[model samples]
Target: MPESPGLDELRVLAHPVRLRILSLLTGAAMSAAEAARELGETQANVSYHLRRLHEAGLLHVVEEVRIRGGLAKRYRHDPESGSRFMSTDPREGQLLLATMAEELKRRSEFRVQGKGGLTADAEMWVDRETWAKALAHAHELSELLHRAAKPPRTRGTIPVSTTVAMFEMRRP
Candidate 1:
């Protein structure tokens, strides 16, 4: 399996722009200009963040196209590159989680607005064995979805955003 993001990568990605850019790149390869259009920012501003992401090794060039006599570089996020991050320093870890949570909330809110995605969570009590069994099942479902989820190989492909988490609630 691919290794998770380290401290340096986490530090670099702490910027909100980088995280947003990474999300756009995840579903498809795009040029800086294309990403700017998606984010409604200047191409130069998007390019700056894209450079930072590439430097952090989270993105890579997949193709280049000649446009208006200039070369446009398209970059794609490494699907296997660091999906998680943790730090021995508590503050740093909290910061990482905070940033990640903000991005996730932003995405979820957009999906909610679109009116076709799922947004639900449940709280439950269970025995150790029951919890373990539920977790195993969740993992299995996630693996199945990951294998099937791709950027539409056919014309009828649908774009979807999904997030799943299950853990013991420690707070009310």
Candidate 2:
């Protein structure tokens, strides 16, 4: 299994732009310029975040292509190698959660109605076995979605948003 990301790595992932970049790369390998164009961000800004994510071991350079006499490296993310953030640091968790909240809100703005969707929220107690089963099932579904992901604007594909954050809480 891959090592869990540390505080600094978590901080690198705590940016909304970086999160979007990660999601984009999961679907296809892309150079920084391509990702920037797809995400509607400046190339310089996306390049910087790509460097940070690559340094933190969250992204891998999968290919290099000659572009205007320079080699542009394409990066990709492997969902199977992704490690769950298991840090006990409250502030770090809060920072990541805040970033996720921002991303969720941004995605909500583009939500299409009248189509099939799911919205679920829960804060309840469950048996240990039940919790374990639920977590495993969620992981399976997440992997399915990632595997099925197509590049942005692919023909005959519908864009969808799936955000999942599951964790066990301590008793008060």
Candidate 3:
């Protein structure tokens, strides 16, 4: 079987808090303190996770500035092409799967409390020749969407977080 890329980094990112942190900062940058406040967590707790993400190269310090007379550090997510996870062990795979489940739960819970349930529908077409073309098109479409969804030029802006989990398997 072909190995998934960035599996290890994905594992690190699978933590609910870490995933939340990334979602919170998507398309923009924020200070650790700001992230903590948005997540209803302590500054120290947010800092710890931010450090881990930075170490994994998933995030980086974008800027450091003084906000309201207090020195603060700002961060941005690292944009990388292809999968960043890098593990093959079954145990690690299980952990990655669990992390994804927890993240989904947290997001769903938040949505329910704020408004109601969210819904989405997807369709796929499968064929040896057409599948390759379709997959390539999807990749291009994703890049375009990412580029078009730029954050507004304002501070204290919270973005809507969306997670896309893709799994594909084939039998011969």
Candidate 4:
């Protein structure tokens, strides 16, 4: 297991490209060239982000193999127990919030283009005990999903941002 990453490390990963690279590696090891092709980016650009991610300790070079008489680096995501969602750096937090705002704007643009827009589905809950248990167990469910992948491989990393927020309604 790797050591938990700190706020600085998280900030290094907060970049859109770096986060996508990590997501791609989470399924299996990949070479920078392959990652670049998958992301529709140039190899040089992919290599840059790959180096940053490795420097942050979020990714590690698992192996170097000979390909076409040249060495190719294979990288994998190495998430540790200390990998919390919180960031100590204010700029990091601000960047994340800004990213969210940008995404909302993008989604709105899609709606204007006739794309199926966003929708909110809500339900009322009265059983605090049950809801709390469900919230706690949801983490376990996510872990299970992460660990349970068939073939456990991917062609490329897709940039995906997820926010799972659970909050109770205010008392009347």
Against the hidden true structure, what lDDT does model 4 obtain? 0.64
Per-residue C-alpha lDDT of model 2 across residues 12-117, encoded as one tens digit per residue: 8799999899899999999999999999999999999999988877899999999999999999987764476557788888889899999999999999998989
What's the true lDDT of residue 17 in model 2?
A: 98
Positional deviation of residue 172's Cα in model 2 after best superposition, in angstroms:
1.4
Best by TM-score: 2
**Top-lDDT candidate index:** 2
lDDT of 1 at 102: 76
Each candidate structure's TM-score, on Cα atoms with residue i matched to residue i, is 0.67, 0.94, 0.68, 0.63
**Candidate 4 on 78-128: residue-level lDDT in tens?**
545215545545666666556555545543543534334335556676698
Arrange candidates by TM-score, descending: 2, 3, 1, 4
Q: Tens digit of lDDT per residue, candidate 3, span 39-142? A: 89999999999898888777888899988998788888744522446456556666767877777766665463555444554655466677677667766766
Error in Å for residue 108 of model 1: 4.4
Q: Give lDDT tens digits, candidate 1, residues 53-86.
A: 8887788999999999999999988645545443
Off by over 4 Å in 3: 1-10, 67-70, 86-90, 110-125, 137-145, 148-161, 170-172
The model with the greater TM-score, 1 or 2, is: 2
Superposed by TM-score, candidate 1 places the C-alpha of residue 159 at a distance from the truth, in angstroms, of: 5.0
Candidate 3 global CA lDDT score: 0.68
Off by over 4 Å in 1: 1-8, 83-86, 113-159, 164-172
